[model samples]
Target: MQNPAIPPLASEFSDLPATASHGPLRIEYRWVNETAATAPIAVFLHEGLGSIAMWRDWPQTLCERLGMRGLVYSRPGYGLSTPREHDVKWPVDFMTAQARDILPALLDALDIGMQERTRMWVIGHSDGGSIALLYAAQHPDELAGAVAIAPHVFVEDISVESIAQTKQLYETTDLRNKLGRYHADVDSAFYGWNDIWLNPAFRTWSIVGELDTIQQPLLAVQGHDDNYGTMAQIDTIGERVPHAQLVKLDACGHSPHRDAPDALNEAIATFIKSPSKAPTSTPARSPK
Candidate 1:
């Protein structure tokens, strides 16, 4: 559950006009610690099947730990935002469109100008992580830094197999019912992400070349037990951006925020304070 105590800074619909390839969108977003007038902003990007609500209290917790403000939102097809058309299939470059177009427009609509952007940090998970990296690459000067957790730079067989299994679970189990709590149109969110990953064309997708242009601080994190990807994801990131800090959590999985919040928080806090230095992983806490 989202922390009810943290007040909404800007939680309204931002109307996005229809483009050549896609329909109009109304993005839903909220802010954390908005009263921190002098603090840098940390934007939280959700995973493939994620939303503002799905983030629970993690954003607030992280923002408080880092002494920064935060922005959390659902992408167009998830949460309270507009749903994808029933007949439409997302393009192969859908993530690219999200990074280059949707995010910029949302920030503009929210009145986050170049000055605010200069101090902004993007922290994302899974698909959102990939988007964060792409955003940092495209607008390196606009952001202070980025943290990508369980991000995929290229397609992996494990990713496909896991996603395919998820699709089956969504169909055969109560997974859709569970996900329905987070998304207004659960099918839209599920299939949009599911169909794309299973698409054969996406197999050739790789974004390593784009990392060459990123100038801001970057931290790529992965878990040893992640089912969706391997250490090669962050390892490849290290290969591209030698200065990027890498963290591999012991006893953690794809979603570190959930699987190992204490360790993730400590690493992020250390990295934000010292970009050039590598973060020392905290000992994993016992599960509740």
Candidate 2:
């Protein structure tokens, strides 16, 4: 449960114009430490099945600790943002569309111009991490750096297995009801992500070939015990981007922020402060 003492942050909405494939959308977002007008912005992107509510107070806590302003928002189909039609399905290039079109449009809607964009940093988890990497690759000069936690550059058998299991849990258990609290349309959020990943055509989907274009400082993190993906995910990132820093946590799983907050926070703070000097791995710590 979220701490009742920490009230929900004020939220604002941005309207994104219709694109070639979809209608207009209203994105739900909030700012952390907005008073820090001069500080660089740290944009927080959630996991595939995450939303602004699912993120809770972590974004605020991290921004305060780092002394940086932060941006947290729900993608079109999650949170209070516009939900997808029940009959519609996300495309194979859905994540790509987010990185290439939706994110930029949100920035524009918020009046964040090119100048502010260049001073920004993207911190993302899971599917969001993959989107961050894609954004970095497509617009190398728009951001200062990027941090990808448990991001998948290429689909693995383990990923498929885990996702398949999650589908079962969603159908047979109370997963839907649990996730419903964070989203206005839980089925949209769940199915959009689950359907695409389980799609046979998506098995070959990989962003490894596009990562060579990213020139900014990059940090890739994964848990030694992550069920959704393996260290090979970040290992491949390091191989592609020589300067990329890789951090593998012990006793952690798919969600580092929830499982190893202290270590994850420390690593992120250190790397964002001194991108070149970040430790390659954090010492093993008990999962929270």
Candidate 3:
């Protein structure tokens, strides 16, 4: 369970206009340490079921510790953003769409200029980690670096099995009501993600072929005991992106930021401070 004692990250909503494939939506976004506007920026992309609130104080805590600004936001159909239609399902390329289009639109809307865009890093978890990778692949010139925690390069049976179990738990337990605390429309958030992952066609979904396109500094982290994914998620990425760094933590599970925040933050901080020299599995520094 997430501790409720941590203060919420301050936020503001941006009323983004309709896109070619979607309608108008409002994005719930927060800036951590706005006073450090000139400092390097790190954007926090939440997990599939996560929201700005669900991220708790990690983004702020990390940025404060690194002396960097943080941009944390909930994507459409999650958190305070617009909800998906009741009968809808996310496309197989949902993560791709988010990376290639939605993110750029929001950055433009925020007037985050080209210079800042080039200086920004992305810290992502799960599906968010995939988005960060896809974005880096398509827009390498705009990113300074990326830290992906438990990111998926390919779909796995374990991931689907866990998601299916979660579906059952949500129906039988208080998971729905619990998740409601973080989302504006819980069903939209839950079903939109669940239906697609459980979709038979999504089983072959993989972006591993495109991993070679990512030229920015990369830090990939996952736990040795991750139930939702395996070491291949990061190892294969490192294989494709030779310069990518990897950190595998012992005695940790899927949510590294929550399960091992100190180590995660330390590794990321060390990487961002001097990415070129970031160690690959170096104990003095670290991911998931």
Highest-scoring model, lDDT: 2
Residues 1-288, candidate 1, lDDT per residue (tens digit)? Answer: 223333343566788887774578889888888789789999998999998888999999999999999999989888878988778889888888999999988898888989989999999999999999999999988999999999999999999999999999999999988888777788888999999999999999999899988899999889889999999999899889877888888889999999989889988998999887664332344244
Q: Write down the lDDT of every candidate, Cα atoms only.
A: 0.88, 0.89, 0.87
Q: Is candidate 1 or candidate 2 better by lDDT?
A: 2
Candidates 1 and 3: which is better by TM-score?
Answer: 3
**Model 1 score (lDDT):** 0.88
Error of 3 at 213 (Å): 0.7
Q: Which digits, one per residue and each the tens of the lDDT, describe model 3 over residues 1-288?
A: 222432344568898788786789888898888899799889898999998989888888999999999989999998877788888778999999999888888899889888998999988999999999998999999999899999999999999999999999999999999998888788889999999999999999999998999999999999877889999899999899999998887767889888888888888888888888978665322232
Clashing residue pairs for model 2? none
- What residue runs in model 2 are displaced by over 4 Å at the alpha carbon? 1-9, 279-288
Better of 1 and 3 by lDDT: 1
TM-scores, one per candidate: 0.93, 0.94, 0.94
